[model samples]
Target chain A: DAGITQSPRHKVTETGTPVTLRCHQTENHRYMYWYRQDPGHGLRLIHYSYGVKDTDKGEVSDGYSVSRSKTEDFLLTLESATSSQTSVYFCAVLRGAYGYTFGSGTRLTVV
Target chain B: TQLLEQSPQFLSIQEGENLTVYCNSSSVFSSLQWYRQEPGEGPVLLVTVVTGGEVKKLKRLTFQFGDARKDSSLHITAAQPGDTGLYLCAGDGNAGNMLTFGGGTRLMVKP
Candidate 1:
């Protein structure tokens, strides 16, 4: 619980719908990351931001996008949700030199 | 791409039993981290190993980093029902700030 908050702890949306998840942090950490946890795949990085307005794609960024408009807020958007994208998403902030503090997580289901 | 492979996707044992989980990789990492995730919650940091051949202990849990910095192992002694959770291993592959995670080991300590 790194003072991070993810909106809509649980969400269910229809396929092809646009969905966005928000992550807000109070610590003002320099690095923030978005990851999705799925069965048999562990947690895969979707996107990460080093600083405000500075973001980069990760291993599984094809169907996802993110933005960091301010130091405390990072947003992940799915332009068109799909069944394959249903999973538990987590937001994390780097802590100290070698660890991370994660938020509670958001569970999204696309039908 | 750097990948971490974890063995024994699932483990179930009676309380008081001992267990070990391993994380292996083809790529070397600067450091490796272990986390425990409970249902509906995000992963919580358990330990971090930075030096090769390093061994650290926390009460009933012992963690060891391989001499090559390419692998790590966690051993839990007298496991309890409270220890049941999804265990994950992560490393900063390519020396990047982002982490690559293993498939994870689901442990169930039945009382």
Candidate 2:
């Protein structure tokens, strides 16, 4: 889908540790987003980037931060991992009006 | 605080049965999209309805958007086991260049 890729497909980290998830795209789409999927809660947006160096917070951005230093890369960092943050995180690139193209996602576990 | 709500959070049916998933919202959207997600993978876009009252069909799946552009539905006819996955509806927010997703409906079509 859109040549979007996510790194560290799976990871287990201790609580209070910092973890960063990477999303890279080959299509050079200007908009990228990070979301976490949890059972019963659905997918909640953490943050999104409109362009290099431009970013904004989404509904569930409290525990997450994002950086888009380059057009092809968007990074999502969990400052301090918590049990509640253990979930599958997805990276999506908006292909204009056609909608989003998502990466396979990264599953994170905090213990 | 969820802008969009999906009914019947979970559904299980036998193959050949028909099922419809509903996504309702109080606010209007520029477009609505349907996605299917399998276990351990990111969601894949199935269809997008842009106009109010617009209806689109793909194979045995049908998607409909409300006349008010505030709701949408996906109906699957003659369901198959391969159709099992999480179904999500997203509304194009048209504000932040992002989408608002509904709590997905998990569907399982048993053979």
Return the top candidate by DockQ.
1
Tens digit per residue, CA lDDT, model 2, B67-99? 999999999999999999999999986888778
Which CAPRI tier for candidate 2? high
- Candidate 2 Cα errors over 4 Å, as ranges: none
Task: Write one digit per residue (lDDT tens) for candidate 1, span A24-84.
Answer: 9998899999999999999999999999999999999988999999999999999999999
Q: After superposition, how far is residue B99 of candidate 2 from its true place, in Å?
A: 0.8
Q: What DockQ do you compute for every candidate structure?
A: 0.94, 0.88
Q: Which lDDT tens digits does candidate 2 get at residues A17-46?
A: 999999999988999999999888888889
True contacts kept of each: 0.94, 0.84
